[model samples]
Target: PALRSIVNPDDARFLNPPDMPKAIQAFCRETRQPAPRTEGELVRCAYESLALKYREVLGWLEELTGNCIEVIHIVGGGSQSAILNQFTADACQRPVVAGPVEATAMGNLLVQVRASGELATLAEMREVIRKSSKVAVFKPGPAAAWEDAATRFAGLRRGN
Candidate 1:
């Protein structure tokens, strides 16, 4: 969380574009800041960038669907990262539900159980999963800072 205060997602130095070498060099030059040298810095940068990107994409999805996304459900191995989950919640201003780390295996088992006629519908299967799995919920934090960061992130996307 301390890193979130210092790391600006709008700063292109945090972004890992497809052409990484060229992009990092250009971003560092443009921002007049040294590139991330330590492992922790690099990891935090990546997490912040990813969280901002998620917020951006969620906006696009909401526009396309004409529906508000209340909560983000993150499964699989990625759900295990409390830091990333909290970052996502903060950046997106939405609750993040992360759990069922062994999602693939659980999904396969659920499908088999469903095929056996024990579960009558998809909702029933979902209920079973929800009841059986342990989940962590991260609610969004204070929005003022994140809102400012989001504005900068949007400007960055627009080539400002």
Candidate 2:
């Protein structure tokens, strides 16, 4: 909610800007909010900004595939962030599944298992992962606000 209140949406700087501190300052100035003074606050803004950027990439993938992506899967250490997962679902207006916190280690192990003939195919490996790992699901809320934000984000990416 705090993120929603401060988001300019139209500002390209929010799209993984070269300098986050500057972007935060600019965003605060534009939205008439005091600049974040604490690392936690800055981190929150950074997470929100990253989620919005993911939304943008999802759009590009959808366009290229000519198919709407139904769910987003986030693996690795970052997937542990429930806040970022929820933000991603909200920003993209889609379902987000985050888990396999140690994805890299899991994948490496899975590959070794496969090489040993324990797994016959990638599908089998996926099934093993699905059964072994726990995932958090985030369903999007209302689309109106996120849609508006996405539009602004797109415009920013296009340099409009």
Candidate 3:
């Protein structure tokens, strides 16, 4: 809810005016839509907006690399948010693997282990972590709904 209040549909920081530094404040006000009144609505708006943004980024990456990104891995504390994880899957129409909630800490420890010569290769380190950690997976849902939402979000973003 806190994020929702600050960054409507999602944070406007990514929007490329470069000069405009606000979040979603100006966009919400300009859209003539009432600001989210309830906590649930606020959270929904925030998560949905974030998911849409993720979809856009994924598209850009795929376009740049000329390779399909089949999966999304959400690491660290953010991975623990089941709601957001599921939203990402739905919005991006891809599978999301969320795990190692304390990923940064584990990564640091892994670095030490590697330096100590315990793990010789990156693959070996990944295998060890894969065996030890518990992860949650979210699969994409119906395409129609997510696609429609994406279209609507794109329109809103374009000031339509």
Name the candidate that leads on lDDT. Answer: 2
Clashes of each: 0, 0, 0
Q: TM-score of every model?
A: 0.79, 0.77, 0.82
Clash-forming residue pairs, model 1: none
**Of models 2 and 3, which has the larger TM-score?**
3
Model 2 misses residue 118 by how many Å? 1.5
Rate residue 152 of model 1 by lDDT: 64
| Per-model CA lDDT versus the true structure | 0.76, 0.78, 0.76
Ranking according to TM-score, highest score first: 3, 1, 2
Candidate 1 — number of clashing residue pairs? 0
Stretches of model 1 off by over 4 angstroms after superposition = 1-26, 31-34
The alpha-carbon lDDT assigned to residue 125 of candidate 3 equals 88
lDDT of 3 at 98: 99
lDDT of 3: 0.76
Model 2 TM-score is: 0.77
lDDT of residue 12 for candidate 1: 48
TM-score of 1: 0.79
- Compared with the true structure, what per-residue lDDT tens digits does model 1 show for residues 26-123? 55446444565556766765677678878889999999999999999999999999999998999899999998898899889989988998888989
